[model samples]
Target chain A: MNSEIVAIDDWNVPHKKSDGVRNRKDYLERLLKTERNMKDDAEPLVSWGFHHYFHGELTRQDLDLISKDRPILIIHRSFHEFIMNSRALSLFNITEDDLNHLSKEEKKFASLEEGHFSERGLIAVMPKVMKYLAAPQRLITGLQITENYFQENGITLIANPGSMYNPSIQKVKNYVFGDEDTPFKSLFIPSALYMLEHTDISNLLKTTEDHLSWGEGKVGFLPKHIKLFTDGAMYSQNMVLRDGYLDGHQGAWLMENDIFREAFKLYWDAGYQIHVHQNGDSGLDRLLDVLDENMKRNPREDHRTTVVHFGYSAFDQIDRMKKLGVIVSANPYYVSVLSDLYSREGVGYERSQQMVRLGDVDRAKIILSLHSDMPMAPASPLVLMHAAINRINYAHEVAGPNQRISALTALKGVTLNSAYVLGIENDYGSISPGKYANLTVLSDNPLSIDPLKIDKINVEATIVEGRPFK
Target chain B: MKNFIFVIALISFNVFSLCSNDRILVAKELVTLDDLYQDANAVYIKGNKFHSIGSKEDLIKKFPNIPVDHLYKDSVIVPGFIEHHVTSTASCNNNEF
Candidate 1:
């Protein structure tokens, strides 16, 4: 297949065009201007602060831009809800006819609604997504989905630890600011960096403006942290813990404590915060010990360290975390979706009380930040806050009813508190003056609405750096 | 704009960082990525670190107080920018690719 480049002919710099945000040109335009010599199907991406749309065959939005050098086939979400576009539809052989025979319920499934797919349909999506696993388009789409889902909420700055790279970061930067100058702001904890250590740690930060690179939350300026993962997930009964479930398994461990501790110290000393993925109490137990040792080795002020999913944390240990000033970014969204699984496998009703202990979090003085454990749950800050306060799961069953918090505090998890977690509270946590006019217009006041109905909350507009997104 | 009030409540603290359209970095410089190096072929930005960038001699003459590196020339250093929040998910060129 001969590759026909859909090149962006003219590039332009970003100019401020919004109330408070900058009217930045898109990245493709800047890239066109930068590598002004390249001959290809590159589209010119112009941006206005957080909004960037493309001017070529490629579609660019925010900081992530996609273009084609040739026609390619790829598998995507494969179902509808229609997140993916025509080109993707062409590659995967998914057709409107495929939906022609489905009932209304199946129509809902295409929108990524959680439910059982026919064993055959479930089996089929894997091979298709796998078929295009190598496609940058798929990766781009994954990040895009992650952003759209999370951004609609009140989250201002946050990042992912999975499958994120320097290249992806640059793409994010492009989408957020386009070819224009940006009053960018964001924070990232790249979990893959856990796989790295020693000189590689020193080197990744050394090479490139690795510190300044953009990512999923890369739309704006952000601090860089090393996001570490040690186990699977809680609901799946995959997280590693010392005690076995009522059943026989003790669960899984991605790494030994000593090795993880050493790596944490390496990252910590390298000036990157250690944001680990530890869900089980046993994992948290081990994590704290490692963090304790690392802190002993390299004590710095406001390390802003954390264990991303500190599920089922013990009260005493939770207090210890507060004393140590470590953060716990919980995925209360799981409260709704997987309460039953955690109840059965991870903990019983009594232990459940401690699962997503938001109330205890406030008491322990631990800075709490809420998140939607995406690919597993919806990434709505409103929904996460509601679940945190309500402690309910997908079935509307309260996971740990006592663990629920008030609407005010829960809201902090997705907003102000998240800023503190990233050490950017001084910059972009709330809507105070001298801060970026990044705001999310909501359908109603959170304080006024019932907590459980929060996810039903609509984002009228996502105003980034003062510009609105429709 | 009505919904912004809700989003405003969500991120009230960081909004200050986006102060004025001009002189946004008007607030005191918050961070500096110092020590750009060789062997790394790294981006040694005298960027937000120093007051200015130019000929090493001129920089030295201007600020004899500050240390000067030959890098002021080869390195195209500029001001460090502040981005609000750019989620990687919005991009079309990621894991979905």
Candidate 2:
């Protein structure tokens, strides 16, 4: 069998055997493979020495190949890089003296200072050092970014419920083959709720019915479940858990039960599962009651109703969830950003210790997955993995060490658990054959590394559909 | 005669009250919202048009005789979700594609 040489050690991502020259050449090759799915033919793999945009020599890509498949590495080109084509060079108005690798602290200061492409500058500028592109180009970049980020953290898939492009599922169904932005391992489908709500439920159902008429299997509208939110996030102190709030307040209920029931009845009758975002334990209880009323007709186990962010689901509620078969999707994102807030809520006492109860979640055997809940947090699986494994404060002290999970379990949350949660378990998750080739190449084996240094590991490559995006 | 009619009405009420309601879904995990949902809740067909809110125990006291409803038990229940400004399902009848 023909083989591709991949750095199984330090760099883990794929590359062609270089004819001679090295450095950034393999990185460039992988980037090409990510943009254009498969390679029709091989090209001369020349060695391109490393260019940090900082020290030593400026970099170069053999100025030999220029095809439709090869758009200029528009983002990586800088004024100093000698081999950059005229088009790539024209994009950047800076020089080598002006370009230097930014230290973590220096980058922070630059964000505040604003001059010479430093902290106070437009960090989003396409050229400084490979800035992420937004649109038209977004799909290409987005897919690679998502693929790389997920793989490095062992996340096989991300079930994206909503996106701007697929406003309604018809648009998603109409999608031809693939989207560049979708670097996800399997199908990143449009959600049912996104289409149903806001539109007349009748019209939405009609659309659903019309689409389903196309027959079963693939390439048609897929309705996993309709998502509903019971209340606000716990980070904001707005969950409706049973024993009231941590404070003396009763969290607000966004919707009245009766109104919720009507929506449920309509959708349930029409055939759809409910995936609700219920943060507080009390909020979960309220949602379960509604599901119970409809239980005579709607069964929980087969229906696969889900509850997210059950930050304070009590031990008793957790037990009930086990019998009911309600899956829990936690924002492991909470391990960072919002940690101290929950920890200090009790004034010196670790409130988060009491808040995020992992033991309750693990004991339920509920299908559990971790996520960044991005925008609130950055979309990195390792960050979530680190949080789930550590369950500690920033000072490296374990916040709820007793409730911490193993690095292996944390990996599953991002990989197997997440793939199932996204409803693409069959394709993503493992290194299985006949599945879409989505892989994450980590600089170090997570199993071998110290758990605390997990987040510090470098991502060598993020592969999507067998192509590497390095 | 009026007293006789009143007595008949009372007897009918007693007969209805005597009938045991359907059993509530009892489980190790019961988050009965019998409190948030009350007897005064408006009913349409069989759906609660407007649920009166209360806690599990409180609602149990209010309707102790009636079989408790386990519809909202143990699960997170939000009242109503309305997605506004998001994409609405509409066909592009303009099959120009």
Candidate 3:
């Protein structure tokens, strides 16, 4: 049988011979013996890779052997969940008694024998592992790689909505500014409200302000906008919702209620454009509450408080958004990838179909733009344009026919609406005099061409400041 | 002698038309993207700026004696597209084809 293996290590097995899963057991057995021999050396378990999707391919016995070598943490593809080997639990100072004492929900995700974890279990161990990967050198190398990739795709601007937490602003600023050959501009927004306890806000603010001219015009720090994550991702089944999941698993909020409110007030009082990463209806409810409260207290106009990754929301929420003047930077590509599976496994068919309700948002006259959410979707604006226009899924079926928009509106979603999201509409959204001479030259105008062929239209050149970069 | 005189009259008219207007561009359709005269079939360009846009006959009549640059008569013209959200983030780095 033919199958695809995304990524696997060849530490012990002959990778050339392991062409298909028929030989997968032999591959696992070889790795198991290597682990057994390694344990005999009395060395700490540094790292080992395994695929969660390859459950049946490898046996429990094989996993047990590998776990004996050292403490092991196995993260799920979604990154919200993880599993630990027997040694890994001890390494993290978690005991059998502690596992048994966990709340029933936590216990459900924790398995003592298999060392499997999800949701709560993963969150418990993530902080410990993140430190290893949060080194500045590692981050700069990764950014350099991604930056080059963006240049090849004709991208000239990058926005980091939150300039805090795992990656330090100074490190990113230094790396980008230090390198004169940096391909595109970087826009950073100060966030990290959750780190208020550990962070010196005054110092962070000073440093953030200094980063405004970090790249001498190429890198800009937007002090007007702040980022907040309201809920978890939809694919991870962690997005909070008013109605529970089909399997009866209640989703979670990334920030506590009080913490979210405090963060909102700090940014709102400061007159910053607040961008929230809200995914589910319940998450929207929380955000709407804050927005309503902010409006009542201060009564600002065109606040442009945006909801990012707005993956799932109710029909009523769109109207609420319009009244509150909340705009959306939604990812319809999420609908294309997850709507079908989410329909069956997560939310019911109805709610799943309603994911990324661009149609309702459009009818409400809400300012809607498309976002790749980068890591979540491909950062091709044309692909985002195509997805918004066709609303096609993995099976090539229209996920939501009503949600499909015209090619013109879809083009605006990527350009004008996107500029609106960044509050840079006056400078870069449209082709008007005095605006930046930025143009994405296409072989065919999306406005007058076949909607299905929008993605196929080759980008001949990207013009920035009247000069073309092919 | 009559045929020669008629040919001279047509050539003189063409030269006068060429010298009167800066340049006239004719196309299958020109979308000015202006609120007025959005669906124009021709455009009149004086120097580097757009002078006027209308149907081919209207443009010709507006600049009755002008040089015409006929191109893309089978194609369409539109305002250049402005792509807004070309993000350079983790999304561009993952699952690229």
Candidate 4:
């Protein structure tokens, strides 16, 4: 892998620092000039930002200079949608009529000439984009950069909840753990959805079997653990709901109902702990339906089928989740980031405020943990705890008042409950004897600190396996 | 010209000074968060592990000749906090490997 090829690549620095870009005009000005040194010319221009706040800010004309030569793909901050330039449209060779059918006139962010592609349109373009990103050097560098950032944040263990069966990940695993001496551990659980898309079930099962004990240094794979997405993201106004969004748009299921049930069964029967990525209430409904069916048929006890992201739910769902033995690994930062925005654009005030629903989950006695889902949110545990305890959004307003959990619960959401989600509770999470002495040495106790000040606490050091990481 | 009592006190100080090099630390409030001694004014460290935690007077009575090494009279100590969910893996673009 050549460093020169990577440093000048379009994917390099696709996201300009958010702080530097004050407004839409400033963003476009930066995008127009951003370029990369070519590596055989098949790559597209990728301008990235991390939030939906940049959604409508980009118009067709704003992409004039950037799209003139090579294809341009502007991945909005949401990761749910993307807008492509006219040149990008040529890759798929689709016209305006082809895209308009993806959404209604009122919601038509995707058009042929403007080349704004999202939802179905974005999904269509993903394969082509991934091909370029799949290049060996790009993947390695991306993981390396990600590893460095996480280490700086005092993270000692990382779980890739939804990963694809890329063999290069093995090389990455070797480089990170074997040669690079990464300070933390990495675990990968192949995305069941991606496996179904690329390979047959048998091969997927075989590959998983081989990687069951794949541990080198700190990198390892959880055998038989699978990830599936039930529905789309709420931030993009694309999550399925019982009543649907205020905009009158209906969210689509990621997998067909029958297919989801069958896929879940194959893994569930094989003794795999299934983790589903579900955001909307309707998505959750589909999951609950499957859980009930699985319970009646197989009747396994203490099976901790987990709901990852567990984004939105009605009050009734909490009791159901507990009864089904479905624990949650939620991104509390979602409420902090998306609640206010969703309130105005999609779900409305009542549902928007209660996105993560930590308090309800606590009252129902469901095991819950918080995750950064990084680059989705920073991989800082304290930051996640802050969002859980405070439930404050970007507007500095507490989005959900009663939904806030106590500092102890919030702290456990990051530590004890997180270990439970990973099924490493016996070895990690608390200060028990014989467990690895991996401690996140903080300047203040999160349990005793001011709720608002939790995120600001400084990390003094990280002790990994009884030795200081540094 | 000193009184006999002052001479006796000097002799006691010399006796206390004989036992030294015992690592001791004092804080405004030392919280072990341990089941046994919940709170203390000072702590003794044997190597890198906690040896004993108690008031300065009790520790002096227990280990008679130990001298205070470091005093953090304003700081609080508790068990090192553990972050349960933080990971070292870079999962960008929705954990797509």
Docking class of 1: incorrect
Specify the poorest-scoring 10-residue window by lDDT in model 4 chain A: A1-10
Top TM-score hit: 4
Worst lDDT run of 10 residues, candidate 1 chain A, spans A1-10
Cα lDDT tens digits, model 4, B9-75, are: 9889777554332355565554343345655767665433356778877877887756674434455
Top-scoring candidate (DockQ): 4
Question: Model 3, range A1-470, lDDT digits (tens) per residue?
Answer: 00012123221121212222213565456455545666345543332223433333232234556766555444332445555556666666654654554566566655656556555554444455444333455445545656554554445556667544433534554465345456555666655443443455445444445545544446666667777778776656789989888779778666668878877877677787888888899999999999899899988887899988888888888878999999988887777767766777668778877789898888888888887655455566777788888888755688878887777677677766777788877666554434554445455666767888877766554544433355
> Which residue pairs show collisions in model 4?
A50-A77, A51-A77, A157-B87, A158-B87, A415-B84
Query: Which candidate, 1 or 3, would have the higher DockQ against the true structure?
Result: 3
Regions of candidate 4 where Cα sits further than 4 Å from its true position: A1-17, A20-23, A33-45, A50-54, A57-62, A86-125, A177-180, A201-204, A213-215, B1-97
Tens digits of per-residue lDDT, candidate 1, B1-97, equal 9899988875774455343222111111111111221112111122221223233344355555333223122222111112212224422322210
Query: How do the residues A261-321 of candidate 4 rate in per-residue lDDT, one tens digit apiece?
Result: 8888888888888889888998999999999999999988778898888778998998888
Q: In model 3, what is chain B's TM-score?
A: 0.58
User: Chain A of candidate 3 scores what in TM-score?
Assistant: 0.77
lDDT of 3 by residue, B1-97 (tens): 9999999999998777555434666666554434467667676655423566678888898788666666445554443333233322222111100
Cα-based lDDT for every prediction: 0.47, 0.44, 0.61, 0.65
Q: Assess the local accuracy of residue A317 in candidate 1 as a C-alpha lDDT between 0 and 100.
A: 84
- What DockQ, between 0 and 1, does each candidate earn? 0.04, 0.01, 0.08, 0.11
